[model samples]
Target: MNPVHDHRRLGRELDLFDTDPLMGAGLPYWLPDGAVVRHVLEEYVREVERAAGYRHVYSPVLGKRELYEISGHWDHYSDDMFPPMRLGGGEGEEVVLRPSLCPHHALIYRSRSHSYRELPLRIAELGGMYRSELSGVLGGLTRVRSIQLNDAHIFCTLEQVVEEARAALGLIRRAYDDLGIRASRYRLSLPGDGDGKYVPEPELWRRATALLEEVLDGVEYESVEGEAAFYGPKIDVQITDPAGRESTLSTVQIDFHQPERFDLHYIGPDGGKHRPVMVHRSIIGSVERLVAHLVEAHGGAFPVWLAPVQLVVLPVGDGQEERAHDVVRRAEARGVRAELSGPGHGTLGARVRAARLVPYQAVIGEREADAGCAAVRLRDGRRPGAVPVDELLERIGARDSDRGTELWAAA
Candidate 1:
């Protein structure tokens, strides 16, 4: 792998994001450019979830200590959690930043009684989660203390487990297909024997493992023992990056313990109350990590749709400045993320070099301005003569709408 294309280097070169000593390590703040990329990715994922029948919700980031205690995280995963803060006076309660969003979703499921018809209720949130990770292990976006998870929970009856799991896997596959990501392999992570961290119910563990196995049948996976989460068994989709390093990018977990521990239930067809199963899944894993992967994968040359600035308009001289600004306004009016750069800022060659990574660049010179058109330059070193303003708008808008990787071919 070329070090120049590494996410850390590209992040600096492109002014994507940064970490400061005063703000602490493992916590990154996104710059304006980085924020645009994040917003685009986030909105895309939200649309995917909406099509999958997920109801989005927002909950408080801090929860009472009793919440984790009841969910068993306080006893099993307290070390990964931040210290609880006491609120109010002597009889005040202690609340801590949430390490995960599962416990909160479970409470949402219980807020109102659900019937058998509402068997497969999916709740999703792109919420912030904090983990007290070791500073030594912290690096660029991949290992961070403050993270945003594309998390969701599906509450359904026992008979619906396989279907829900299949739907979740389909969602992951569709997302990866759209982004051109391929999973290297799949692993069925199971609990190990004599682990004090895991719940000690052998019957529950066996049933959950069996259900997951049924869900993953004929799906080409390796069964790995001792890698399951404390609450249940899971299927992890692993992807190998361009650097030959492997990481889990998506996961589907069948959790039977949490629903029981929290007494989550729904009315069945026979008019009897029955416990509902919960499936925890994340399609993109962490938003920060996904952005890092894409940065390295594309060498900071994002697809036209995902690029922070899809088009950069450069005025060749002072006389063309007004035309350049007008072109920018036209692009923006048509929903394109466009910016104007003047010759005052830098030489024409210098400005073009700086915007070399952008998918499309437009040079508005004297003749082109007089003719009301742009001399379009593509990232692939192709200048396709002067394109009329209306045609330029249509081509760029089509590429953005189609999420094409290259402007010339897309046009």
Candidate 2:
């Protein structure tokens, strides 16, 4: 991998995130710039989910140990889960950092009675979960202990499972397109033969696998064994990093085991109770992993809408500082993530270099500032040149709103 394209190195150079030896491995803290990027991306996800009929929900990161046991995580996935923490005394109540969000989501669905009208209840959350990855294999945000997953669960009748799963895949594709991500391939992740890691219900496994296959009817995918979740089969959207290492970035999983274990059901048209199928889908698996792939893929040059500092106002000299500040203020009022880089930072060239990865660089000088305009430079080395402040903002706003890759809109 090119050092410039490595997220670990780019993270340090870009002041995005950092890991502390004292804080332990696989745990990293986001710097201000990085936080901005994360906040924007998270908002983007929420917007997408909202438009897709997913109701947002909040759940605690820690759950009773019994919760996972009931969800089959404790039995089938405890090796990757944190050790249970007992409260009060050894025999007292035990809790653990959740390894996945589905268990809590299952509890939420069970919290209320539902009719067939709300059969396909989609619940979404940008929530945190933890993994107990060994230190030796941990590196940067790619393999983090704490993860903010773009997770959602759909509870629907068995008949609605295929359509819901198909819609979830469509959502993933839409999100990937907007984020400038290209999936390497689709994978039909199935349980391996005689794998104790999977749930013992052969019927549930077969049914879930068949449903996923139906969901992927026209899509190209490779069926791989031992990659399925313990509860069921899944469609894993894989992406390759700059280093050529492949990883799952997004997924749509059909879980029959959870609904059975949790005894979840809904009132059907026949006025009788029926089991609701659970579909687990993640548009962007983990925020950390997604950002890591983004950093490497874009080489720290994020799309304008996702850029930490969308635009930087650089004053060519001391005379233009006030004008530059005005430009930043106006940009901020318009919700653009703009900042001012003054002469005190060093020469104009140095300031530009510092913000090289920023989407838009607006350079102000005596001439342009006097004329109430700024010379515009794009991160991709396009010099649109001397666009009026209002016009510049309006153009950028259009691009941002569209989530387009173009730095400037067409005339």
Candidate 3:
């Protein structure tokens, strides 16, 4: 990647995140600006999930070793997982940092009995998980040991699996459009012949793979072998970075193995217990990788709604300092992220250049301050002339709410 477009470079320059040698590789800490961006994205995903009938829940990051044993992680995926830590000297219970959220979610579903009335129970969480990634392959946020996953699992009957998966794919597409992410293609990742990474169940694998195919009906996708999950097959949404590297950014999977291993079931109308299918979905994968892609995609200039410092108020001279401060206050009152760049910083032009990535800039001078207006400068270098404080705030709010790429509303 070019230094100008690399997320690692931009992250350092924009004060997004950084890694400390003491903290170990693949572990990066977010700065204030980065935290704001992450917080906004998290809230946005939660709102989308809630509106789509998904119930949010919280789960711990650590799980008992036996949990993964039952969920097949220990048997099939222990290498990529951290070694279990013994609580006591040597004979105490062992716990592990989970490599995936599914096992814990499975436990949550089994906490109580369910009926067919809640067949399509969609559960969502923005949770943390850990991976034992090799240091040689770790770079930036794209490959990290700790991950905050935008993950969900749906427990539904056999009949509801197709529709649920379809809805998940639609949600992913909608989110990408709003986030300014373009997917390269859809990949149907199937298990390769004699691949031991997959669970050892031919009939179960066949059923799961067929069901995913049914869900992908009419969707343009490429079938690739050896990319399926250990427990099931999945549809991977692939994307390319500015550096020409391709990776999966979103995914949908159908797993019958975990449901069977965990003995998950729902009561049918006939009063008989029936096994429920598990559909795994992620709208934007991990928060770290998503932000990395976003940083490179936008070159640190985020959309207005997602930008850390959305608006910066600049005073042309000392005489307009009070006016600039008032503008900042008004913008903040209206729920816009606003800051002030005083004349002491530098020339108005220099200050503007420094904050070039900011979405909006409000420059207050003597004439504009007298008229209770400010010269509006957009990040894209378009001047909207002098706009009244109320009108300026309204326009910014409108663009932000719409999540559109356009800085100003159409006339």
Using TM-score as the yardstick, the better of models 1 and 2 is: 2
Q: At residue 206, give the lDDT of candidate 1.
A: 91
How does residue 290 of candidate 2 score in lDDT?
A: 95
Worst 10 residues of 3 by lDDT: 191-200
lDDT computed for candidate 2: 0.93
Judge candidate 1 against the unseen true structure and give its global Cα lDDT, from 0 to 1. Answer: 0.89
Give a tens-digit lDDT track for model 1, residues 269-352. 899999999999999999988888888888898888888998999999999999999999999999999999899879999999
| Candidate 2 C-alpha error for residue 45, in Å | 0.8
Residue pairs clashing in model 1 are: none
Q: Which residue segments of model 2 deviate by more than 4 Å? A: none
Clashing pairs in 2: none
Per-residue lDDT over 304-355 for candidate 2, one digit per residue giving the tens place of the 0 to 100 score: 8888888999999898999899999999999888999999999999999999
